[model samples]
Target: MAEKKWMPRWFYQLASPRWCYQITGKLLPIFAVAALILLVGGTAWALIYAPADYQQGNSFRIIYIHVPSAILAQSCYMMMAVAGAIGLIWKMKVADMVAKACAPIGASIAILALATGAIWGKPTWGAWWVWDARLTSMLILLFLYLGVIALNSAIESEQTAAQATAVLALVGLVNIPIIKYSVDWWNTLHQPATFTLTERPAMAMEMWLPLLVMVIGFYCFFAVVMMLRLRNEIIQRERRSSWVRELISG
Candidate 1:
């Protein structure tokens, strides 16, 4: 009799492209609906109900968009790098696909954060752009994302591309902490983190709640987008597989 090796079932399932595709198909609607509801409710609450900053006034509302996007950008990059690492270590095609999907979405989110930051800064800092530590690190993050995308595209072989991008993503992981702590490490104009796990928020509940909603909404939105992209990547890469052929024919 063969001895059984114990491992988490879901972890094994994640290695299956078919399972991933089907599971994400089931999950996509749930995330899409949640993202829609939370984003809409959160945006409305931030704009109408949340009290304005006494100093910044209505302009502070931009944080509702800017903060969530900024957080998501960093989070997505982390996910991408980790997924790439998994693909490299385990040779899981689904993980490689997930890493590839994360690049474009993260790059877009990074761009949004940068744009909103610039818009907010014009009013607060009396300048459209400044070479602040946090902002500079974030810009570097965008470049890292672009580099992964470009490197993957440049390679003709899929496996080679995945390997190359994974290495780049892993190398870029060093920047994540730098971006997070840039405000503390340097005397930049960028403000300190608004939300922290260790401390209470400095803002009122009315103001904090909507921001929280927006952050959750953004994460839901990211999940939906990532799953959609992942499914496509799976289908594209698995097109020759029997199950995929059956799925397509059906």
Candidate 2:
């Protein structure tokens, strides 16, 4: 009789860098395809099918992009911080790499959110920029991401760099809740959330369904990009290893 295994074999296999590279390579194409299809389909549905907002008019359509990018930006930062914590706690090199990869991606997404918010604001609020609480907190979030990246790059020692960045990432997490609750805690120009966990979406289903698709597609795209960056990082860091040499030769 075969002995029962205490944990799934793949769980252990994931600890191997080579195995991770191979598995992520296989998974990337699937995520890439899904992201492309969903993004394209969602964009079409949003632009062509969804009706313009009665109050904000067509300018409100930017929400499809703005909201998803903002959501992803915050989520990516949380992921980075969590990965950094794991790396600091367990000394996991892969977790450190994941944390490093997340910084620039999160920063870029945050910028997208800020840009789209600005554009949406011009038509709605009649201003190019405002020092609203939500906006200011989001700007701080972007700076935190940049700080992590800059700190990691400034340090010469890889281990020290990872540890330093991990501390910074963990510290930045306090701002996330502030960003989320800024509108509620303070009188702000930005509107309340369109979707909420405790209540139905304020927008009609026709308006929100496309936004949902865009949000999912954005997440899928983030996964695809993060995995791509991780694979590159693994290759660069593991270049001296035999498996990487074999992969390069093959």
Candidate 3:
């Protein structure tokens, strides 16, 4: 007989809700600690050590928060869409749970980005709001997040809801590129990206370093939040499983 290849045990464990919950439980604390340290240290560095913009002065510090939130929001949505696709394709409950958990977090971060952008704009643009291409596309991203959240909640069957939301997420994936390229495609008041792989930073190391810290801190924070939410989703979806029952009883 020909030899048959089987997936590794570790891969199977990763697909298990119980295993995922346990792994996340171990990981959550590490990410939480990292998030706390980085966010606090980054905030202090950004506020106290980083020099002010000659033109914008202290107002430029808000970029530490705004840029990170905006980046995280887009990243979260992309993850959610990919998770949703996994659920749809593989019928993996864990992927559905992950997708479900991502929506509210992504929405909240998107809102934070928008709010901070508005605040940053007032000083730079002398206006609180503008119909800029980037701004409008970001707004559409927020709406897409809301649509997935609503669709999931509205469906009666869990599997049906997952499928519906997955399709919606896939459709909405088109908007992500629009948001990314909006500035280049159209002349907008919004500034270009601060950090790009191909281009050297325009700002001094003192300015960009704290911003880098804040960005890393934001990513750690997102991991912490998403793991917490994913753990809850696992428990909720797997309540009937023996591990969940034991966990609850314990």
Candidate 4:
């Protein structure tokens, strides 16, 4: 009884699909509003107010979109893998759904990163394509996302699909650090990190501040989309449940 009393209410509540769906519904609007404000404000500030690079000039402005998408693409894979692991270990349906939802979103962001990188490359490197270490690893990351999506679609059993993708995602984790450190590890055409946690930004604040806003805005946008997808997954998976049925009825 004492142990039960000590247990957090939200801990058990997290296991309820209905609870999660309702909670996400409430939170989605807040994320949407914040994302809209930050993204619009950041885009305007970066494109208009930020000074051009002394070296790269206005071409460097692409970083405003490229960097954030790259960051999100990697972060989304990590989140998907962690969620997959949770589903595998504890058999959480919500966790499985979350992992499934992340694939398409992550894949799209990875493609955006690659496209932007290619566009940036033409000006800086005088070529649109290169087999550089960072570029290759990021390409592999895109393939990994695609593999997960493909595997999930091919498998008929939902449980089996989730478990299989979980293993694949875990295996793919090895590539993330490789993608991160490839520029350092190899003589590559791609530049090193613009922002590092251990040191001050290499670029000036005027340039990086809008990037900061864009990054935050991208994260907010990711949250909003993930929640929306999760809610839809819950509704589909839980359609037979009384709560879902009542929700539909009402």
TM-score of each: 0.97, 0.95, 0.95, 0.96
User: Of the candidates numbered 1 and 3, which has the greater lDDT value?
Assistant: 1
Against the true structure, candidate 1 reaches a TM-score of 0.97
Where does candidate 3 stray beyond 4 Å? Answer: 1-11
Which pairs clash in model 1?
A: none
Q: For candidate 4, report its TM-score.
A: 0.96
Candidate 1 lDDT over residue span 1-250, tens digit each: 1233335565689999999999999999999999999999999999999988999999989999999999999999999999999999989888999999999999999999999999999999999899999999999999999999998899999999999999999999999999899988999999999865578998888999899999999999999999999999999999999999999899
Which sequence of candidate numbers ranks them by TM-score, best first? 1, 4, 3, 2
Specify the poorest-scoring 10-residue window by lDDT in model 1: 1-10
**What is candidate 4's lDDT per residue for 149-186, written digit by digit as tens?**
99999999989999999999999999999989998999
What overall lDDT, based on C-alpha atoms, would model 3 receive against the true structure? 0.91
Q: Could you give candidate 3's per-residue lDDT for residues 1-250 as a string of tens digits?
A: 1223345464467578988998899999999999999999999999999999998999999999999999999999999999999898878888999999999999999999999999999989999999999999999999999999999889989999999999999999999998888988889998888755477899998999888888999999999999999999988888888889999999
lDDT of each: 0.93, 0.92, 0.91, 0.93
Q: Write the per-residue lDDT of candidate 2 for residues 93-186, one digit (tens) a residue.
A: 8888999999999999999999999999999999989999999999999999999999988999888999999999999999999989999999
